[model samples]
Target: MTPEDLQTALARALTLAESGLVAPGAADGPIDVVAPRRPENGDWSTTAALRAAAHPSGRKALAEHICDHLLTLPEVAAADTADPGFVNISLTPTARARAAIDAACALQPPRGPWSNAGSGPWSDAAVDPNVIGALQLRHAAACRERRRARAAGITTDEADSSTLDHPSEARLLNALAALPGAVDRSRRLRRAAPLVTGLSDVADAVEEWLSRCAVTPTIDEDITARHSARLVLVRAAIIVLAAGLRQLGAAAPERI
Candidate 1:
């Protein structure tokens, strides 16, 4: 599931809860749905309830109420409240896989809200050279992943959600799903830093997944469901990183 999808679910739950809890204008602004700092917390989490709660005493109740509604979403497998009004949510693997495949299928055109990035007389005066270098490395890694997947005889058509059970895979999928939200936040803040950071974070997740999983089996006969799933996950990450780089007015070259 994409971050926008989760954010919409959170907003709906918040609206429903607010109606009963007397929280006025609670969903007025963009609600930030993010990867939890700790995976055990959930696939994603949001602090909208804490911000929406009219009073400190109401935060926990509002969070719980919102989660009650969050559970109703088809994509969400579980939803629960953490202390101080954080809503942690886990999406079904099926949902995440479906979204990842969809993203990979549309990789060529690249997705948007990219219009907000503008046809600017852009400058690098405020840019971080380290961040740019990191992005370049991610571009190179994605290219290598593409090559590896091809060598393994895995393609986008083989991407099956039923086999996507690896923890690292889940982390990478969630990071991909969160890209649009990261882009939006960057646009809203009028700074590319958020988007740069998001891209870097996603790259880190990709590396982590790669380190733990073998996309290319040592033997042809060893190819399995996990390999196919990993291939799709790689493609999805490639799509997202390329799109983010484009948004920053950087070229995401095939050869880095």
Candidate 2:
């Protein structure tokens, strides 16, 4: 089944357990579903019923009910209630491959901006030169401080200088400072430029910041204009990660 489909089925089963229709603690079982260690067994397997049985009645019966429900799904070739109430499921190979492909495709480029395209507040409204200047100055000062500490031969366990010593950090700072100008230039050259080319470059800059600064992106409407600009940079970095996962034939969940 598709990831969404599997998730939905799991949710439904959990709900049944919570309502006491199944054995107590079934909802809290260690394994949601299990796959066979040996290929001869089946595509997937589960000991959820056995785990649930530790608590209460009709565990085997409840497992059979769950297996019956799973067997109704198109992707499931068959589902059996094994000895001691195990639910083993065999998936159709075509269904498995299709699910994988859909997941990979969902990770493809330009998943779109974090900004809502409909009527709402635009980020440009909050941009402030003064705040941007202050942030830049603060970063520059920190870099200078690290350099001075290194020059003075002040070595301490608390002060790990490897990152600060890297030239890539300097390049990232330069890129961050130039982002506004680069974005502006991209807008001006819209007619001659590729649709997402400049945006991709901005994404690269954000990735550099993430690798160096470890900042997470958020969608806060109340943030200052300067912080909002940094949020845009973070969004670009997320897009880069998504693109990379797509190229690698892997899927990144929307809410990882």
What does the lDDT read for residue 74 in candidate 2? 84
lDDT of 1: 0.75
lDDT tens string, model 2, 119-236?
Answer: 1122234323343333333333334433443444333333222222223332332232223333343345532122123323334443455456522223343323333233333333
Candidate 2 to truth, TM = 0.39
| Candidate 2 displacement at residue 210 in angstroms | 36
What are the runs in model 1 whose C-alpha is more than 4 Å off? 18-20, 101-107, 110-126, 188-190
Please, what are the lDDT tens digits per residue for candidate 1 over residues 6-102?
7777777766664446367777667888778888887888998888887888889998888888777788889988898899988888888777666
lDDT of 1 at 201: 80
**Candidate with best TM-score:** 1
Find the candidate with the highest lDDT and give its number. 1
State, as a TM-score between 0 and 1, how close model 1 is to the true structure.
0.84
Per-candidate total of colliding backbone pairs: 0, 1
The 10-residue segment with the lowest total lDDT in model 2? 114-123
